[model samples]
Target: MKTDSQLQQDVMAELRWEPAVHATQIGVEVEDGVVTLAGEVSSHVEKWNAERAAQRVNGIRGLAVELEVKLGALDKRTDVDIAQSARNILSWTGSLPEDAVKVLVEQGWLTLSGEVEWQFQREDAAESLRSLPGLTGVSNQIGIKPSPSATVVKAEIEATLRRSAAADAKAIGVEVHGTSVTLTGAVHSWAERDSATRSAWGSPGVRKVIDKMSLVY
Candidate 1:
């Protein structure tokens, strides 16, 4: 006693696909929306794709992820192989020091650990890994340290920000305790807060910049 349209809507909601997508692949039946998918995709990842795609169809009371995982299409690389490939990309790019950063991939989730000479490099490492497929999230614990020539870097960051925020250099407190810079002060607007942080990074000697600026609205 189920309607065709009702079943279709259920599967679609489960996946949160676009309206246009629902309109296209909605295959309805008298009993339920029996979604039958066919294809030859690369790996087990795509095997899940078939199920997930059918799942988002709306009224899928039952699903058949019967699609075969075409191993021939895949390189037969283990998860560790993909993880090493991901690490190599980050290391070869010198996003962080080699061995200083560790990459671990499990079921497509990329985890990174390491120390870098700059906040930029730490961030770069995390970003590069995020681009890999099947990433759930990144645990970026990369520590940053000031370069030997960070004084110039700090000065440059400050100069660039001063163009926007009317920051009294004295009002902005800067404390360099290791590889991180603690910024304890206040800025007028959100824009000023961002500008101030950018200035801090421009300074070559700084590593990470933490701001304690509360918006005064």
Candidate 2:
């Protein structure tokens, strides 16, 4: 196990290594394995990248982001412009069904709400808008169209876990209730926990994934 100081240093170093993040503008603080990131970033993409860089470090139990996005003068745009850009991008995205997702913009924040057949489509809609200039934040309310029975969902998640190299299938427990899946167990690292959760979301009918898994570090 790494000490809190060592963990903080590693996270800072990882932030520096990520090209998309401005490491000097971010502050990393670790306490009992939980990392808190505080600072201001120029873009929402930079803020997102900073968080991902911190999560890549080992021995992290939890993460709290206090970073704020402060758009530069050149990056700022009107809400109408932002909304038009979001619509154009969503329409051009081949992974999403035509007109399946609706977009709303308020004060530079974009909100997407609709239904999609797969979780990846829902994620792709939001991810494609992250780098948009003048965008402050995104609210991804796109829901999954439920399919498959509970038994099949559970079995597919278990099979995915077993096949994933990052996760230990035996160490995790899966429970399915309708379209919702609950994961309960202990994972050795954040990567394993993320892998297991992603597997649960990949199931055909899964709508919500409740992660009750703890990181052992």
Residue-level lDDT of model 2, residues 108-193, one tens digit each, is 88999999988889889999999999988889999999769998899999999999999999999999999999999999987999
Clashes of each: 20, 0
On the 0 to 100 scale, the lDDT of residue 2 in model 1 is 37
Quality of model 2 by C-alpha lDDT? 0.92
lDDT of 1 by residue, 1-217 (tens): 2355665555445433532232233332324445454444444444454455555442334455444434452345566876877777876775566678887766555677766676677767866764455444456776665455445554555566556444645556665555466677765544555567766765554656788754342
Candidate 1 has an lDDT of 0.56
Give the Å error, residue 55, model 2.
0.5
Give all TM-scores, in the order shown: 0.50, 0.97
> Where in model 2 is the C-alpha error above 4 Å?
none
For model 2, give the 10-residue run with minimal summed lDDT: 145-154
